[model samples]
Target: MRKDRMILRTPLPDRLCHWAMVVCFFLVALSGLSWLFPSLNWLNGVFGTPQMARVLHPFFGIVVFAALVYLFIRFVKYNLFEKEDRIWLENVKSVTAGDHSKPLRIGKYNAGQKFMFWGIMGLICVLLISGLVIWRAYFAHLFPIPVLRVALLLHAVAGVGLMLLIIGHIYLAFWVKGSIRGMVTGYVSHAWARAHHDRWHDQISGKGADKTKPGSAR
Candidate 1:
C-alpha cells in the first residue's frame, strides 16, 4: 500500500548541500575516470582532456572537499558515536532480518547511517591530504619524493574506497523504503518514519509515537 501523507523535514540548506555533494562527486568521478585509463580518454571531454583532467581533478576535488567540510561542520556533532549506536551495531542481525521490534531505538541517523557518515568523513580527509601531497606544480615540490609516492598510493586507495562507499550508500538508501524521498523532498510520511527511522522521526517531530495505536495524522 502507498502512503497518503508525508512530512517536510530537512532544512533547505541541508538539502542543497546534499545535492551539491552528489553533483560535485559526479563531476569528480567523471574527471577521475579520464585518469583511470587511456581507453577512457574520451571521458575527459567533460572537463577537456587528460591534461585538463589533470588540472581539473584536483580543482574538482577541492569543491567536493569544501562542500563535505561544510556538511561535516554542521552535522558531525549529531552523528557522534554513542552508547545506543553500539547497541544498534550489536543488533545488526535484527536490523537486517527485518526484525526491528527488538532492535535498539535510534536517533536522527541510525548506527549504519552514522557509520557511513564517518566513513565518508574519513575518505574525504584521506583524499584531501593525499591529493595535496602529489598536487604538484605548486605544492607537491615541497614534499619528499618518497612521501609523495606514499601519498599516491593512499590517494588511489581512497578513490576506490569512495567509489565503493558511494555505491553502498546509494544501494542502501534505495533499499530502504521512503529513504530516497526524505533525501529528495526533505520530508517523509509520519508512518514511514515510524517504520524505518522512528527514532529520527521522533527526534525531529518531538517524541516517539505509539506504533500499535492510531494517532493524529500529519
Candidate 2:
C-alpha cells in the first residue's frame, strides 16, 4: 500500500518494543513451563541449557515486564474506554462473525482490545510482584517460607493466565487480516482502518469530529 494512503497504526519504537518483548516472553514462558511440569522439562533448553534457563528466566521476565510497562505508557490513551465502546460491546457477536454492517464507533481499539490491554497489564503486574518475591537469587531470602510459597503460587497462576491471554491475542491478530501487518509495518490501509476502527479512521482522516481528542477515545 502507498504510504500516503495508509494510516500509522503503530509507531516504529512501539513496534520494536512489542516484538522484542515477544521474544523475551517466549523464552521466559518456556522456562517457566519447564519448571512447572516434568514432561516439559526439555523446553528449558531454549536458553541453551537447563541451568542457564534457571539463571536467565527471571531476568527475561523482568525484561518482559519493562517492555510491557513501556507499551502501557504509549498505548493506554488509545485503549481507554469511551461511551461508544458500549456499542461495540453490545454487538460483539456480530463483530466476531466478521459483520460490519453497522457503525460500531470503535476507537483505535475496540472494547475487546481494551479488555485485552487491561487484562495483560493487570497480569503482568501480578507476575512482576510475585516473581520478585519468589526470585531465589535475590529477594526470596527476605520473605518467610509461607510468604514465598504464596508468591510462588501467584506467580505460576499469573504466568499461565498471561500465556493464555497472549494465545488469544495471537488468534485475534490472525483473525483480523491486517492486524499483524499493521504491527509489523506500523501502518494499515485506509480501508482496513475504516472497517476495524471507524471512529479512529474518521478522526485520523478528518471525516467526522469526535468528542474525544485525536489519537484517543477518552
**By TM-score, who's the top model here?**
2
lDDT tens string, model 1, 34-147?
677778768887766567777878888988899898889877766877677777888888787877676366666778888899999999899999998899867899998899
List lDDT for all candidates, in order.
Answer: 0.76, 0.90
- Lowest lDDT block of 10, candidate 1: 209-218
Error of 2 at 24 (Å): 0.4
The runs of at least 3 residues in candidate 2 whose Cα sits more than 4 Å from the true structure, single-residue gaps closed, are 208-218
My TM-score estimates for the predictions, one after another, are: 0.85, 0.95
Q: List the residue pairs that clash in candidate 1.
A: 6-189
For model 2, where is the 10-residue window of minimal lDDT? 209-218
Report how far off residue 98 is in candidate 1 (Å). 2.9
lDDT of 2 by residue, 1-218 (tens): 78766777887899999999999999999999999999998898999998999899999999999999999999998888899999999999999999998999988999999999999999999999999998888999999999999999999999999999999999999999999999999888988988999988888776665433333332
Clashes of each: 1, 0
Task: Report the lDDT of model 1 for residue 115.
Answer: 81
Pairs of colliding residues, candidate 2:
none
Model 1 collision count: 1
